[model samples]
Target chain A: MKIGIMSFAHLHAEAYIQNLRAIPDVELLGIADDDAARGEHFAQAFNARYFDSYAALLSAKPDAVLVCCENSKHRALVEMAADARVNVLCEKPLATTLTDARAIIEACERARVKLMTAFPMRFSTPLVEVKARLDANEFGRVYAFNATNQGEAPLQQRAWFVNKDLAGGGAVMDHTVHLADVLRWYLQSEVVEVYAQTNRILYAKEIQDTRVETGGLLMLTFANGVFATIDCSWSKPPYYPTWGGLTFEMIGERGVVLVDAFKQNLTLYRHDLKRAAWNSWASDANQAMVEDFVAAIRDDRPPRVTGYDGLRALEITLAAYESAERGEPVRL
Target chain B: MRVGIVGAGSMGVVHAASWQQTPATLAGFFAESSHDATRLAEKYNARVYKNYAALLNDVDVVDICAPTHLHHDFVLQAAAARKHIICEKPLARTMAQGRAMLDACRNANVKLLVAHVVRFFPQYALAKQNVANGSIGTPAVVRLARESARPKRPPNNWFFDFEKSGGMLLDLMIHDFDYARWLAGEVETVFAQSIATENPDAPLDFGLAILKHKNGALSHITGAWAFPPPNFRTAIEIAGDAGLIEWKSADTAPLEFFLHERAGDFPDVGLPSSPLREDPYTTQLQEFYDALLNDTPTRVTAEDGLAALQIALAAIESARLGKPISLAEARA
Candidate 1:
């Protein structure tokens, strides 16, 4: 049950540290980031041991590692973890390219360890409820999904989110993978086609150095004949209540279901803040996700969301990018 | 001025109610045989005409709320009678029909207001105005989803026939299609997917469409006939650099009552309504009436309706063709 965090590059590590703390059996062994200052800061802030480097942390023989590195850096970190015979819970997009995603999966397979994508939304309470109903055929045959995974540009907390090289792409690359994995899981089908359009509407001028799309609309067709659109955008303003939210309306033959996963919140207007803010009281999907990651290693079984799932999602993001460039639908 | 509604179905009853709130008088309603239409006519202290021609003869303005396939004929007959027209959306089932309806109205020198009611919705109008006025800077991405309960209809009902009703895209989603264009000038391309069910009981349909606007904006629109009645939902999120505007029917409603013994079998009762004082349909009809009185122009002109229809048709074509369709190719 010993686990180490690979990098604090992605902000989700801030929450993951607390999530791992809540688990009874899982020990958050230590922190490891290439940036010594960052490694020392979080290790002290969270009251954990600090390692000089990711390699040093891996050599310490932690059972598993959580890779919260930048989008493109996931492959390197994951490959590094696999080389050390460690299981991995990698952050989303899996990798910038389909080849890297496939290679990561193969490397993990060869090393005899599981690689799980950090798609926490798969464990989201409300979304999980919907999936159960869908699996039970209570929603009849789901026909379409209208979903959005939107947020304010992660410029302040993680500048790498907007960096084209580090993040792979912008909003589409950053957000699309979460729902893509969920859709494949719910529909039990792989995406057959991807048609997408991206825009530099929100942060083009603000982040002039990096040329990346801040907004994207994607249309996807599943093998089961289900169709969906994902609005993955960093469109929330800085003054908004929180980062943003994930919302969807699922259409089915029996009935329609609407999910606003992050809607459980109280609007707080504090004197210290300039604007109103939403204080969400949502059940922690991240906590459940990490728990599953730990359970998989303990049971010596595959994680609920696997490396192939990550590969499938990565394929979607890459196809979306290709389709947007060619101004057409890219067939699988 | 007097207003008579044609094909007294759901939209007919709604338009009849809206007309009663205006300065104009309610002339009557014409349907093949609609019990609800008779009830609505009685409630408004109006007649239920046995024939379409008779209703057109009496009313100053003809409000066509018939099936999609019948709009062209209804509009043509109304225009021949030299009556001003208020037509429910999709404009027409086909581009040719929409263009013909526009030409007929123009040649007759009668005012034609394609009743795109969402434009008159205060929230939607305000959101569009905010985007135009730079409240959100340059509008990058517009996202919208409209969900309506699939009301039970007779097996022979025209609404059950996709050919007659033009399916969910034309019947339900054309509203969002119009709104998307209103928010982002004109659409240059459309890609879409649809699920058409064969279940005799529900016969539900769901559609998703993506529009790339000429203004460098992208819009995602979803239309569904799946939810339970009174559980109808609408959501919009327009994101730009300066800010974001988001709203949902369930969230913004002034009242919410989750009755324990409610919401199955019997559907369309007291729906969750927001704090808006006047009904949006009333506002739309009144504006059209005033335009006819002043000999000015309606807010949603026939050309605008045609344009929205063109985009909707393009989406339908995209879904049918399994390809990304340019607006020009769709029009051709």
Candidate 2:
């Protein structure tokens, strides 16, 4: 399988590139980014070719491409990859808008190429075990879910993250989609309505330009009567543990299940770093996601996480924004 | 100070024990069932009043630990008797009731202290102090979770009645709601989702409320009554520009701090590790007693209790209406 990365915008791209290189049967074709400096830097660092233009990378005829462009730029790159008939594993929040997401999916369908949305939480080992238990009906009827996906502000790593136009929105856009996709998959239910509250409080003094929200809480009601609360916020401090964490409590009739996706970590208090940091020694969810995407193309099968799945999650995330704006729930 | 307690249930027992530790005399207590009142009074070496009014007449301060639905009447009676008041959380079930209670206390010119014991918890109190001291910079976001087993109530207990207890949002989550409002400012809007497995044979309840603070802060408040007995856990995370403050009951370590400064000892600042010999309940009662003796204002005022109640009620309404409720609309 030949896999090329579209852009080096999202920080996840760095880890993903490593995962791609580690796969035995996979050939990492090259990297492409409109930002020539970033593209060239990563390419040189990884010992891979750098394509100045996305089209030039597609000309190499890679079997699949990982879309790591800005949130707002996902649609264009996915459409381009689809036009070239290359399967794509797009980063979370498929696109900034439902229209763009639909266009991306439609383009892929028209070109007869597979489109998978990156949702690595579904591949996290602990969450995988939880999903397995849920599948076995060990929890009976799930009553509610309290989940959180939190991270530090990405301003230091990706300045575009706080830029609404480039990143789509702040914490809500960046974090909500991951858990939204996971909940939908785990419960096998569609969200019927969404209500959200958001704020730009975290970086009010430091951030003067962006209109994005740094903290947000989304309430979702699923069709199956299960309700969930997702706390998606860029509220972690820079010197804290690892970048972020994902955790949840699932309440059911028979029993309750608590899961911390990033709990397999060792905490080290570093005097030089001047902070206690969580070093995660858990299985690489990103590696599993990359392998799944590659195996789907190699096996001539649909990726476990599809473009439509992305669409549904994106719809919830977009509705959350709308709900926050209107100060009311938005029904799907 | 002579103290009288209403409702000889678990909370009443807790209040009685705490009051015993204070300089106040446990004059008497009243309950719907004389059996419970007598049992609790005997344990505390106090007398059991025949009725609420009798207890009110005998005491200088009225401590209402009654069911939530009875709070309004108790407050009105205590205020009419011109006694200082200390009431357990969720001041009243409805907004009108809460407002009337607040007005009555104000009109009677007596100190009205609501038992929002969470504010007295060392972990939470330290977090608030740190925020006030600008240790974490200006607070931007807060995530709070309180999980406990279903309350062990006798048959026909008011807690099981939605109208009486206001379900988990009022009965269980009101603590987080009050603490959130205390940490952040006034709530501008609330969006909530809840689930209740109300079957007598299989009881479970969960609630999540998102409060968008008027000051641009955001809070995610979660409460659960689905865990099995002897299991109660709470976790809180506050994030701001300079750093983050986190505390979890499941963690063996003290409250964790992660500041952005990178050239000092790990954690930068440390919280006291020694546990307080006094319980939060006792601390709260002692504070109330001191305020009464000094003729100073109580830490948590009637107005603050009213504000917390308003948020809780709005969250409940939002969950029922399947929408977010604006504080302005709630006031109107």
Predictions' DockQ, in order: 0.72, 0.58
Top candidate by lDDT: 2
Query: Residue-wise lDDT of candidate 1 within A148-208, one digit each (tens)?
Result: 8988888878778888899998989889999999899998899999989988868887776
Candidate 1 ranges beyond 4 A from true positions: A23-28, B2-5, B25-60, B257-277
Candidate 2 lDDT tens digits, B123-238: 89999899888998877778898887777665797888988999888988888898988888899888888888767766778888888888888888988887765456788988
The 10-residue segment of model 2 chain A with minimum total lDDT is: A201-210
Model 1, residue B37: distance off in Å is 7.8
lDDT of 1 by residue, B99-209 (tens): 899899999998778988888888888898888788788888887878776655655777667788777788778889999888888899988888777787666777888
For model 1, what TM-score is found for chain B? 0.93
Q: How does residue A144 of candidate 1 score in lDDT?
A: 82
Which residue pairs clash within candidate 1? none
**A22-51: candidate 2 lDDT, tens digit per residue:** 999999999999999999999999899999
iRMSD for every model: 1.2, 1.5
lDDT to native, each model? 0.85, 0.87
Candidate 2 chain B weakest lDDT stretch, 10 residues: B265-274
